[model samples]
Target: MAGRQRWMTVVCVVGVGMLTTAGCDGTAEPAAAPTSAATRSVTPPVPRDLFSPRPEVVRTPQEACGGTPFRAGAVRAYTPDGPRYDGPGPHPVKLLRMESDLLGMGPELPYQWTGPRPAQLVVCEYEDETFDSRQVGTCEYLGGTVLGATARVQSARFVYRVFEARTGTLVRQFTLRGNTTPEETCPETTYAKTALYDQQVESKDLVAKIRPLVERDR
Candidate 1:
């Protein structure tokens, strides 16, 4: 929303819910301590009530978020207004994400992706409900602290998208901003570089929120 503001953990593109909700997992943590730098982590996103753009909505899928070359239920043409700012018919979806240190606070850990990116736009979908309620925006060394304070800044960007499932179009998009300046450079917080793990988690969580909506509507 606003430009980078101090230290950031996760900033999903959506302003708020449907916009959704969030969490993260415990992996190999680093041995350093966190420096006392003011930082903010973004929250999850989900639609109001439980769903937006009900399932009955229809259209093609976003190629940016879509995994394959040909997205499902999406369209190539824009709206009559001429710009396609709004996503397609709308299957229903909200922005989702988990914040983590990209600086490597511990042993380097890699992540796996269940979906593809740079996708057409409609491909932006998440389905990880098992671990949705976690609030792990930033990763700090298990036992580390910043002493005396220092002048250091290291930031990384996170990428994601919001898709309208019915038409498979991307309604919104987000690129997160974050950084870390451990008092002790040697010991800092690190997060998944690949970030796919977090993405998968986000997708599943969104699905969880949509479940009730899908059922009631069905």
Candidate 2:
């Protein structure tokens, strides 16, 4: 959101929940080996929770959309607002609209749309439930050593929308929250180029909760 911060990982964008990591570049000097008790006692800086809290009350899609779903006849018109992809294969699904702050991350990965292109093109809209970006930089050696850190946490709304392409009819709307921050990365500790995999294991629990929905889609 903030004018592209330092070192963002370039990801392959295929479909919702089908993200995979690509290569990265940057640099960091190796963290000086701890030589003293004070150094050993000092713990590395961790980012604060990136996600903001959401309302406690959850609403069903029927309740949210007034028992009917929202529909769009064409997404290409909105391509100027976001990226739009024409039907990858032959099904009448005219177009797809993707809106995200991470759009600048990288190019879309190559993928084949497998399945009968539905007689009615279904537009699936993914709303991010939790999108948190945070960073911290510090001088490690009693305010002498300089080190920088960053992390991100993302979660998607369970209730995604499916709409008919031509008629703009809403159909097959479902709520299944899944894939909460299933993947993550952090700045290399010693040298910024390290590309350390600093994923918080705690986030895996969120992924587990969403796996069933992902599997169902597959």
TM-score of model 1 vs. true structure: 0.22
Q: Going through the candidates in order, what is the number of backbone clashes in each?
A: 55, 11
Candidate 1 structure quality by residue, lDDT tens digits, 1-218: 23757774642322322322232234432333333455544566755657444343222333224433334353332111122323332222322222223332311111121122211223233222332233224323343354232222233344445443333354454443322223333333333221212311233443443333322322
Give RMSD to native, each candidate. 31.0, 31.0
Q: Compare the candidates by lDDT and give the number of the best one.
A: 2
lDDT of 2 at 213: 29
lDDT (Cα atoms) of all candidates against the true structure? 0.32, 0.33
lDDT (Cα, tens digit) per residue for candidate 2, span 73-141: 332221122212232323233213233213322112112222332323333434434534232222221
Question: How much does candidate 2 score in TM-score?
Answer: 0.29
Report lDDT (Cα) of residue 162, candidate 2.
Answer: 50
Cα lDDT, model 1, residue 57: 28
